[model samples]
Target: MALKFKMNRKGWLAVFAGLLLFAACESDPVLTGDEVSYAGDIRPLIDQNCTFSGCHGAGSVQFELLTYNQVKLKAAAIRREVWELQNMPKDRTMSLEKREKFKDWVDAGAPNN
Candidate 1:
């Protein structure tokens, strides 16, 4: 019984050490080559946060941000309101990382993609 207990304890210790090594060897997630796109990244974010609450959608703001062109036209304003001033969504707020992505998109000339 004593020998069995010792073997099990050693086995558990080895497993724990292996797990630590595995976790330490793992790398942080990497971003792929595809640059952020308006359609892919920006539009979806706007659709969820901006357009849905009768905020920037139709019959809400004087300018509707539902479409790509509309958003593109107002990219500078979006950057100011969202990134610099951080007064958008009027309820909660986007994560800082998301806000950075939005700023990057705007800085990249607000592409239609």
Candidate 2:
């Protein structure tokens, strides 16, 4: 019985280690080469986090950021809000993972991948 328990524990540890390794090695898909500047990175992230979070969705916000062109139109403002003013992504639910993704996108020229 003790041997079985030890084997199970080792197996679990191995599995956990493998999962961590995989997660650590994985990278976010920010911007590909065949993409535009506005569509790939900014719009989708804003739509997912800002709009879908019930903070700025349909009938929720005065200005919706649900589309590429919509977000593209406010490129300077969005960059300003996030990078300069630090006033966007109004939810604490936005993990550093998401923030890093957004930053990487911005750094990658805010492309449309």
Candidate 3:
């Protein structure tokens, strides 16, 4: 004997809807703007902005950004302050281009390279 399964219209619709929801919830990995490098792109920016005397470099703040480990630890906060809130630096603002670079770096998992 063979077994068969049949679904009513409502059941089929429910399954279809669930599949759509599942697919919609799945997101592809984001490829940020040109590849950003910690040494080549991010470090210089951080040095210029947050690494001056009495700043993030000198351990003045609760955290620091002088090294890759420190910066990675604070990556989420950095993104929020620099990109989302735009209230960091406390003295000046980063340019649009620089902010975009930072955002890209953060999106790329804040890699040390």
lDDT of 2 by residue, 16-109 (tens): 9999989877875654564333455456677666786466676665676776666556666666666555677774465555555565555666
Model 3's TM-score against the true structure: 0.66
Angstrom error at residue 47, model 1? 0.5
lDDT tens string, model 1, 1-113? 35544458889999999999888878643657656788789988898889865588887756789878888889999999889988886775689888887899888788787
Best by lDDT: 3
Cα lDDT of model 3 by residue, 1-113, tens digit: 99999999999999999999888878765666568999999899888888877778775667677778889999989988888888777765678788878888899899888
Clashing pairs in 1: 38-113, 39-113
Q: lDDT of each model, Cα atoms only?
A: 0.82, 0.63, 0.84
TM-score, structure 1 vs. true: 0.66
Candidate 3 colliding pairs: 38-113
In what order do the candidates fall by TM-score, top score first? 1, 3, 2
Candidate 2 TM-score, true structure as reference: 0.46
lDDT of 3: 0.84
